[model samples]
Target chain A: MHQSRLTRWFFQNVGLASALLLFAVLFLSYNMMHPRGFSAAVAVQNANETAAIAFLAMAQTLPVLLGGLDLSVGAVMTLTNCIASELVNGSPAQILFGIVVTLLSGAAFGLMNGLIVVYGRIQPIIATLATGAIAIGLALLVRPKPGGDVDGDLGWALTNSVWDFADTYGIAGGGDAWWIRPFADIPVPVIIVLLVTILVWVPFRRSVTGRTVYAIGSAEGAAFMSGLPIERAKIAAFTLGGFFAACGGLYLAIQTSSGNADIQQAGAYTLNSIAAVVLGGTSLLGGVGTAVGSLIGAGILRVISFYFRILDIDPLLQPLIEGVVLLVAVSFGAIRTLRVKNKLDLFR
Target chain B: MRISVSNENKPILIASLFIVVILLAGTVYTLSTAGTAPLLSPKYLLQQLQTGSFLGICAAGMMMVILLGHIDLSIPWTLTAAAMTATAVGGEMALPTALAVGIAVGMLNGFGVAFLRIPSMIFTLGVDTVLRGLMVAQTGGFAPQDTATPLMLFLAKDRLLGIPVALFVWAAVSVFIIVMLTRTGFGRSIYATGSREGAAYLSGIRTRFVTMGAFVVSGLCASIAGVLLAGYSAKAYQGMGNAFLLPAIAAVVLGGTHILGGRGRYIGTLIGVILIVLLNSVLSIMQMPEAGRQIIYGTVIIAMLLVYGRNQRVTS
Candidate 1:
C-alpha cells in the first residue's frame, strides 16, 4: 500500500520534475553541439524566449482558469510594442512611460473582458475574440509597418551584457551579439521573469485571494455561495492576465530589439501559451494549477522551438507541428478533466 | 431548461449590435470615401452581399453547431476539399456529381465530430491540415488547368436579375436552416444539449446525433460556399478559404450568437456578414495598409461586443 501510494505520487508530480530534466537536457545538447564556446549567452537567449512565452502563458492562465481563453495576447503585445517604438520620442523616460501605459492599457483591456464576461454576460471566448481583433486593429493604426525603433540606449542595455558576472569569470563566456543573442551582461528580462515567478506565482499559490481564484475556477457557484468574492476574483484574474500580456510584450521588444506589428502574425503564441499551461499540468477546465507549472510549460515550448531550429526544419512546417501539439495537449487536458468530472460534483 | 430560455433571451441584445455595426460601417465608409455612395449603390452592395452570402451559407450551418455548444474549426478545409474536388472533378462529370462528392466529404467531417467523441474544434483543425495538404499536393499549390465548361463559368459569373446567383443560394440555405431549427425535434435537441448537457441527456435527447447533424450541415454549407467562391474567383487556390474563418466567426458573434452555444440569430449573422464585407471593402478603398485594416476591424468588433453585453445586462 505504501509503495503504491508513493508510485502514484511520483506519477502525479512527474510533470514538473521532468520539465526541469528536459531543460537540463536542452542545455546539455547545446553544449555537446558547440563544444568550445557554448556559454551563458545562449542560455540568456533561451531565457528571453522562455520569459516572453512564460509571461504570455501566465497572462492567459487567469482567463482560462475561469473557463475563458484570451486570443488577444499577441494583438495586445503588438499594440504595446508599436506604442513603445513610436511614442517613446527617443528618450529613455518616454520609453519607460510607454511601458507603463502598455501595462495600464492591458489592465484596462482585461477589465473590459471581465466586465463583458461577468456583467455583459457575453461568452468569454467571443468577447476576447472581438477584443483581440480590436487590439490588432489599433496596433495597425499605431504603425502600419514595423518602422519605429525602440530607444537605442534602452535596447542596447537590455540586449547587451554590460558587466561580466559569470561570463567574465569564464564560467560562461560572453561573445558577439546576434539579433536574438542571449543577454550575457545583465539579462534583465530573465530577472523580471524570475521576480514574477517569486512574487506573483508564489503569492498566487499561497494567498487567500489566489486560492479563491482556484476555487472560483474549479466551481464558481460553490465559491460564490461559500462567501468568496466570485465576481471580483474573476475580474481580477482577467486583469492580471492583461498585465502579464503587457509584460510579455515588453520582453518581446527586448528580445527582437525592435517591434514589428506583424511579428505577432504567427498564431503560435496563443496556442503555445495554452499548450504550455496544460503541459505544466494546469487543469484546462480551471481551478487546479500552479504558476511553476506554466514556467515549465513555457520552458518546454522554447526547447521545442530551439530543437526545431537546430534541426533546420522548414519554418512553415512548424505550424503543422504546433497544431498537432496543441491538439495533443488539449486532448490530454480534456481527458483528464473528464476523468475528474466523473467523480467530482465540482463540475456541476 | 426553463433557465436557458432566459439565457437565450440575452442574445436578442446582440441583434441590436448588427444594426449598430451596419450603421457604423456605412457611416465610416461614407466619411472616409468622400461621398462614394457605395453603401447605397445596389450593384455594389449586391456584390458585397453575394461575397458575404457565400460565407453566410456556411455560417448558417455553423450557427447550429455553435448553438449546440460545439464549433467546427475545419470549415476552412472542408471548403477547400469541396473546392478542390469540384474543380478537379467538374471536368469529367456533371456539376451535380462533383458537388455530391464534396458534400460526402462533409458527411465524413460530421462522422468524425459526432461518432468519434472528438472535440469538434481539434478534430476539424487536424482534418483541415490534412485536407490542405491534399489540396496542395493535388493542385501543386496552384489552380488546376481544367478548361471549365461555359456553364460552370456562367453559373459562377452570371447575375440573375442583377443579383448574384450565390445570394439566391445563400437565401435558400438560410431559410432552410431557420425552418429546421424552429420546426424539428433534432433542432430542439441541439438547443437542449447546448443549454445543459446533463439535462439534455436526462431528457433522452440524442445529443450525439444532434451534434453530428450540425457538422453535417456545416460541411454541406462549406461545400456550397466553396462552389460559389470557386465560381466567383474562377479557381479554388490555396488559402482561398483562409480569409473566411475570422469573418465567419465574426458574422456569427455579431449576429447575436453566443460562442459558448445555445443561442443565435441567422438574420443577425446575415447582417454581420454584410457589415464585415462593407467594412473590409471600405477600409481597402481608403487605402489602409493590411495591418491597419486588421487593427481597425479588431477594435470595432471588441468595442461592439462590450457594448452589446453591457446593454443586455441593463435591459435585464
Candidate 2:
C-alpha cells in the first residue's frame, strides 16, 4: 500500500496499457493490410461492427468489478436488440420511444438479476444464467422470425463516417473543416464509446456507489464491516451494467439495420464479452480493472476477426484461429501463478 | 459426530419429492386432455430415462467438478470432438479414440485450471472454442458425413431386460462414480478442496491433483455422452453438444450439489435429470411453444434454487 507513486501507477494501469497497446498493434496491422488501407469508411465499418461486443464487455465489467458475474448481459442484449428492431422504425417519435423502451427493458431485466442475486441469495452466476434464459425466451417471443428493422435514417447516421454525419447535420466538422480534419473520419461508434465513457463510466467510477462496489469485490465481509451499502451498490452495478448491455443491443440494431434473437449470437456475445473483460485485465475474482481496458480488449478481439480476413486465411479456419488466439491471449494471465512455491498461495 | 446425517440426505429427498410432483402434475394434465396416463406409463418412463442417460453421464462428471466448485464449460465441444473422432476413425479403434479424445481434453482442461491457475470457467470456455475450431477445421466448416459404427449404436440403442442400453451405461457410470466418491481418498479431497482450497492444501491434500482429476472425470463423462449421443443420432454434428451443456449443469445443481461445491449426491443428480426430462415432456404434452418451454424451464430452476439454495442470505 505504501509503494512509490510511479510504481503504483505502472502496476495499476498495466492492464489498460497492454490492452491499448494490443489494440493499437493489431488494428495498425489490420489497417495496413487492408486494400482500402486507412480509409474512413473502413474505420467506421470496423467500429460499427465492434460496437456491440464493446458495449457488452462494458456491461460485463461492472458485475465482475462487484465480485459477481452477470451471465444475462448477452440475453439482455438480444432482448433489447429485438425490442429496438420492432420499435426503432417508423416516425421519429416512434423510434425515440422504441429506443427508450428497449433500453429500459434491459434495465428492468438487469434489476431482476440484481434482485435475485442480492435478495434471493442465489449465486450471481447461476441466478443470471436462469434469468438470461428467460430473457432469451422473451427475445424469441418478440422476434420469432427476425425481420424487424431500425429506422433507415438513424441507422445510416450512426453507421456512417463521422465526416459524412457532420456534413449531413451541417455540423462544423463537414468537408474542409480544418479544425476537425484529423477527427473527420472518426467513426460514430468511436464517438459513442467516448460519450459512454465520459457520461456513464467516469461518473460511476468517481461516485460513492462505484467505490463501494470495488470494496465489496475485493473483500465483501470487510466491506460489510465498514458499513458500506453493499446491497444497493450491487444493485446499482447490475442496473448500470444492464443499461450498457441495452446500448450494445441498440448498437447492434443500428449496425445491422435490423435485429436477430438468435441463441447462438447471444451465447457468443456473452462469452466474448467475458473474454474481453478477462483480457482487459479485470480479475474474474473481482475488484480489479477498468471498463476502458475492457473496451480496448473488445476492440482487440474484433480486430482479430478482421485480421483473419485481411490475411486471407481460409474462411473455415477463422473460428479456429480466433479460438487459438483467445486461448493464447488469456493464457498470459496464468503466468503469475507459475512463480508461487507454496501450494496454499494458489488459493489467493 | 454421532448425530444422524439428515442434512446430508436432504438433496436426494428434495429431488425425489420433485420427481413425484412433476409426475403427478404431468399425469393430471395428460389425463384431462389426452385421457391417457402417458406420464405414468412404463414405456414413457423408460423413454425419459433413456433420453436422460446422456445428461446423467454429463452430470456425473459435472458433479465431480461442481463438487470442487468448478465447472467444465467444454462439455459441448468435448462431446462433439469425441463423436467426430470416433466416427472419423470408424470401427475397432472408434471407442478408444473417442474416450481418448475426452481424456486428452479433460487433461488439458485440468492442466490449465490446476497448474496455470486460470479460473476453470474461462479456461474451459477457451478450450471449448478451440475444440470447436478444430472440429470445424476437420470437417472443412460443413457438417460431417461420417456415420456411427455398429458397436456404438449397440451401446447407445440396444436393450436387455426390457431396459434401454443407455440406461445400463448410465447405471454403470453412476455405480463407478458412487463407489469412487464413497470409497476413495480422492473423492474426499474433492469435498475438502471445494470447501476451502487453502485449508485443503494446508491439510496436506494435493488440491491441484484433485482439481485436475475432477476435470478429467468431467471430460471422460462428456466423451461418453458424446459417443452415446452419436450412436443415438446415428452421426455426430457441430452444435449437437450445445443442447447438453446448460441442461447438464442444471441437473447437477438441481440435484442439490451445492453449485459453489462440497456437498451433493449422485442419486440426487439422477433424480434431477429425470425431473428435467419429465418437465420437458410435460411442457410438450401441454403444447407449450419452444419459447414458453424455455421460460418455464428457467423459472423452475430459479424457483427450486430459491427454495433450497437461499441459505447465503444478503443484508443479514
Candidate 3:
C-alpha cells in the first residue's frame, strides 16, 4: 500500500502478510496448546524442520518471481546432501573443506539449470525436470543408500541450543551473561536462518539484479524492450535459488546426521515448496512476492504438520491435510480470475 | 499429395527413422554381447509390446491434456487411486469403479484448469498430493492388501490367440485417440483451443468443454492402465503408478507431440511409446543399473524436446 499527501507519505506492502499472519496465528495457538509452552528448545526444533523447507520455498520463490519454475530444487538439495554426508567428515579441516565443496556443488547444479534454461532455450519446467533427474541419479551414485555419517559433533553444535556459542563469543558482552542466559537455549539453526535472511535475502532483494528479476517476471517483453539484463538476471535467479536449495540440503544432512538418496523425497519437497510459494502470496504467474512471504509460508506448512503431531493424529492423514491446504490456497488465488467479466481478459 | 503429407508429418517420420536406428543399435548390442537375436524375435517383440501397453495407454491420456496446452501431473496417484479403489470394490464393480474414480479426478482437474483458470501443472500437482495422501491414509501406509478382480486378470494377463490382451487394450485406446483427433470435430477444437484459447472461445468453440473432455479422456486412460498393472501384479499397492508418470509424458513428447499443446501426431506418439519400450528392455538386456537408466531416461527426454520443442525464449 502506498499513499501520498502534500504533507506526508505512507506506504504498506501487504504482499508478505498472508503467510506471516497465518503462521503467527497457527504457531501461537499451537504453542498455547503445547505441553511445554514456548520453550527455546521447542522453538529451535521447529526452526530446524522449517529451515530446510523455508530455504527451499525461498529457492522456489525466485524462479516463480521470474515467471519460471524449478522442479529440481529438491533434487539439487538431495544431491548436495549426499555429497555433504559423504564428505563432511574426518578431520576439522576436511569438514570445513567438504562444507565449501558441498555448497559449491549446489551452486553448480543451479548454474546447470540456469545454463540449460537460458542458453539451451528449454522450457524451465522440462529443463528443471531433466536436471532434477540427473541430480537424483548422481545422488544415488554417491550414496546408493540412506546411510552416511555427518560429523556427530558438528551436527550437534549446529542443531542444539546456542548457549555455548553465545557464552564463548560473549554476545552479551564480557561483563555478565545473565540477560542472555535465557536466550542461550535458542537453537543455532534458527539463528542461521535469521542471519541468512538478514545477510543474504535482504541485500539481494534491494539489488538491481533482483529488480531485473521482478521486471522479467512481470513482463519479459517490456523488460527486454527497456534493455534490462534479462539473461544475466534469469541466470542469477536460478543460481541463487540453487544456492538456497543447497543450504536446505546441508541443513538436512546436519539435521538427520546422515543422508538419503530418496527419489520420493525430491518430488515431495518440490511440490511442497510450490505450495508454500503459492501460500506465501506469490503469484504463480510471477512478478509479485518476497522471500519473507515464502519463508512464512514454509513455516505455516511445517507448523500444520507439527501441530497435528502434537494432537497425535494418524501420521498417514498428515499429507492429506497438507494437500488440502495446498488446494485451498491455490483455489483462493484463482478466485481473482473468476471476477473477470470478460472471458478474453482471463488470458492476460 | 504424397509429398505434402510427408512434409506435414516430418516429425513423425523423423521419429520413425530414430526408432529404426534404436532397433539397429539394440540388435548390434544384443547379438554382439548376448549372442542372441532377440531384438528382432517376434516373440520378444510381442512381449515388449505387452509391457509397453500400460505406458502407451497412460501417454495416450497425457497427450490429450498436453494437446490442450495443459498438463495433468496427477496421473501417478490418479492411476494408483483408481487401481486401489477397484481392488477394494472387487468383482463386477471393479471396472466401473476404476473408470469412475478416474473420471471424477479428471472432472476436478478440468474444472480447475478450464473454469477456474488455474494453471494445470500446479492444480493437478495439488490434486496428486491429495490423492497420495488419501491412498496412503486409506491403506495406512502399507500395501492395499487386495487381490486383482477376475476382470483385471483377464484384461492384464490372459493372452488372446498368442498375443497378450494388454496389446489389444493399448490398441483400443490408440484407435480411439486417432479417431478422435482425425475423425471428430471435438478433436479439431482441442487443437484450436490449445493454439489460442481466447480465439477458440470467441469462435464459439466451447473451449472449456473441450478441455474438460480431454482431461476426462486422460483420466480414463490412466485408470485403464492402473487396472491392467494391478492385474499384472495380481494385487493393488501404493506407489505402483509412480514409475509410469514421467515415462508416459516422455513417450508423448518423444513421439513428436508438442509439449506446448496444439501440433502433434498420434502416430508419432505411438512410435515414441514403442521406442521407449524397446530402449528400456534393451537397456535391461545390456545390464544397465537403475541409476544409469534414470540418467539416460532424463537425457533422452531433454534431448528429444530440444530437437523438436525449440521453445520460444520466454520464461512462461
Candidate 4:
C-alpha cells in the first residue's frame, strides 16, 4: 500500500519531473556546445535572466492555483522595471526607497485587479487584461524611451556570483573547470530564488490562507458555503502575485541596468509565464501545482533557447519549438478528457 | 424567426445612445478647436464607416465564436499569416489563398477544441505562436516584398456610388451572418451549444460540429479582414495584425454580447464597431499617445463590462 502511494505521488508530479529532466538535458547540451563548459560567468548570466521569468511564472502560478489567471503580471513587472530604472539611482538610501516604492506600486496594481474580479465581479481574464493595459500605459508614462539608468553597484550585487571564485582562487573568470562545483556559488539571483521558495512559498503553502486559496480554486461554491474566507484568499493570492511580479521587474532592471517600455517584451513574458505554469503541471483549470515546479518549467524554457543558441540554430525557430512544446505539455493534461464517462464532465 | 429585442438587450440600447453622445462630443470638440466641419458631416461619417468596416468584418466573425462561449485569440496571427500568404502568392490567387489559410487554421482550432476537448484559449494561443514563428521565418524578419493584388486594392479602395466597396463587402458579409444566426439551423445550433452544450447534445444537436463551424467562420472572417487591411496599406508587413485583436474583442463585448456566450445580436455588434472606430478617430485627432489610447481602451472595456457583462449568467 505504501509503495502504491509512492507511485501515485510520482505519477502526480510527472510534469515537474519531466521539466527538471528537460532542463538538465538542455543545460548539458548547451554546456557541451559552449566554449566555456559551465563557468561562473555563464552561470551568473543564465541565473540573472532565468530568475526574472521564474519570478513572473511564480506570480502566475499563485493566481492559477486560485482558479484564476493574472495577465497583468508581465505588465506589472514592466511598470516596476520602469519605476525602478527611474528612481534606483544615486545614493544607496535612494535606491532602497525606489525598491520599496516599486514593490508597493506593483501590489497596488494587483489589489486593483483583485477588487475588479472580486468586487466588480468581472471575469479574471478580462479583468486582468484591462489592468494589464493600464499597467503598460503606466510603464510607458514612466519611461517613454528605454534610456533610464539603474545603480551600477546594485546591478553588480544582484548579477554577480555571491563568492567571486575567479578573483579569490586566481581562476580567470572561474574558467570552465568549475562545472562540477555545487550550485552554492551560483549568482545572487539564484540565491534569491532559493530564498523565495523557502521563505515565501513554503510558509504560504502551509498557511490557512493558502489552503483557502486551494479550496476556492477546487470548488468556489463549496468553499463559499463552508464560510471560508474566499474573498480574502483571492485578494491575498493576487496581491502576492503582484509582489512577485515586482521582484521580477527588479531583477530585469538589474540585469539590463535600464528600463524599456516595450510592449512586445511584456507580451512575450505574459505568454511564456502561462506556458511555464502549464508545463510545471499547474492546471489552467486551477487547484493544482507548485511554484518550485514552475521554476523548473522556466528553466526548461530558457534552456531551450540557450540550447538553440549553442547549436547556432536560427532564432526564428525558437518560438515554433516553444509553441509545440507548450501544446504538447498542455495536451498531456487533456488526455483525461477521453476517459470522462459523462459527456458533461468534458465541458468542465 | 426574428428574436425581438428583450429586456436583456437594454444594455445594447443604452450603448446605442452612448455612441450618439460620443459622436456629438467628438464633433463638438473638433469644431471648437479646429473650426473644421463637424465630424458628423457625410464625407467624414463615410470615412469613419469605411475604417470601421475592417474591424466590423473581423468582429462579425468573432461574434460567432463569442456566441458559442469560446474565443479565438489566434485571430491576430491567423490574419497576419493569411495576409502574408496572399500577398506572397500575389495576382488573382491572392484572395483564394488568404481564404484557404483562414479556413485551414479555423479547422485546426476546431479540431483541438471540439474533438480533443482542449480549452480554446490556450489551444488557440499556442497555434497563434506557431503561426507567428512561421510567418517570421518566411519573411526573414523583414517586410515582405509582395504587395496587395489589383483586385484587393480595388475592393479596399474603390467606391461604388460614393461609398467604399469595402463597406459594401461588409454589408454583404453582415447580411450573411445575420441570416445565418437568425434563419439557419446551424446558427440555432451555435446558440444552443454555447448556452448549454450538454442540454444541446442531449437534444440531438451536434454540438462539436457547431463548435467547429463557429471557429471556421471566425477564421474565415479574420482572413478577409487581413486581405482588406493589406489592400488598405498596399503591402503586407510583419506584426501587421497585432493591433486588431484587442479592438475586435472589445467591440464584441461592448456590443452587449455575453462573454461566455449564448445571447447577442449582430446589429449590436455593428453599433459597437462604429463606436470603436469613432473613438479611435477621436483619440487620434486629439493626438493622444499610444499609452493613453491603450489606457482609454482598457478603461472603456472595464466600464462596459461592469454595466453589461456582470449580470449575464456564464454557463460555461
Number of the predicted model whose lDDT against the real structure is largest: 2
| Ranking of predictions according to lDDT | 2, 3, 4, 1
TM-score against truth, every candidate:
0.80, 0.96, 0.93, 0.93
Clash totals for all candidate models: 8, 0, 1, 0
Q: Which regions of candidate 4 fall more than 4 Å away from where they truly are?
A: A32-35, A164-184, B1-7, B311-316
What tens digits encode model 2's per-residue C-alpha lDDT throughout B105-130? 99999999888998888899999999
Select the stronger candidate by DockQ from 1 and 3. Answer: 3
- Compared with the true structure, what per-residue lDDT tens digits does model 4 show for residues A27-51? 8888878988688878888887799
Candidate 1 local lDDT, B1-316, one digit each (tens) = 3634344344455545555666566666677658556666778878777777777877787787788777777777777667767777766463665467556655655666555455565456656665665666567667776534455566667889887877778888988887887888877787887887667766787766677677778778887787777777787667767767767887887777777677666667766676777777777666777767776776667666665544232110
- What does candidate 2's lDDT look like per residue over A256-314, in tens digits? 87888888889889999999998888889899998988998899889999887678678
Model 3, range A1-348, lDDT digits (tens) per residue?
233551241113344665676778999999999998698768877878888998999999999998888989999999999999998999989999989999899988898889878888877877788788888988889989898998877887787677755544456663247886666777788788788888888898888888999998889989988888889988989998988999999989988989898998988899889878878878787898888888888888889888885797888898898788878767765767767898698854
Ranking by DockQ: 2, 3, 4, 1
For every model in order, the TM-score on chain A comes to 0.80, 0.94, 0.91, 0.89
Q: Which ranges of candidate 3 are over 4 A from the true structure? A: A1-15, A164-183, B1-10, B313-316
> What do the candidate models score in CA lDDT, each in turn?
0.68, 0.88, 0.86, 0.85
lDDT of model number 1: 0.68
Instruction: Write candidate 4's Cα lDDT for B1-316 as tens digits.
Output: 9757675686688788878877877778878899785577898889888878889989999999989888898999899999999999998889999999999999999988888887787788889988988897888888999989999898888899999999998999999999999999999999899999888988999889999999999999999999998898998898888877777877887887877789888888988888889888888888889889878877877887787677532222
Model 4, C-alpha of A70: deviation from truth (Å): 2.0
lDDT of 3 by residue, B1-316 (tens): 4555453376677677777887898899988887888988999999999989999999999999999878898999999999999999998999999999999999999998888888787899989989989998999999978999988999899999999999999999999999999999999999998888889989899998999999999999999999999999999898999888877877877777777778888988898899889888988988988778778777876776666655677534
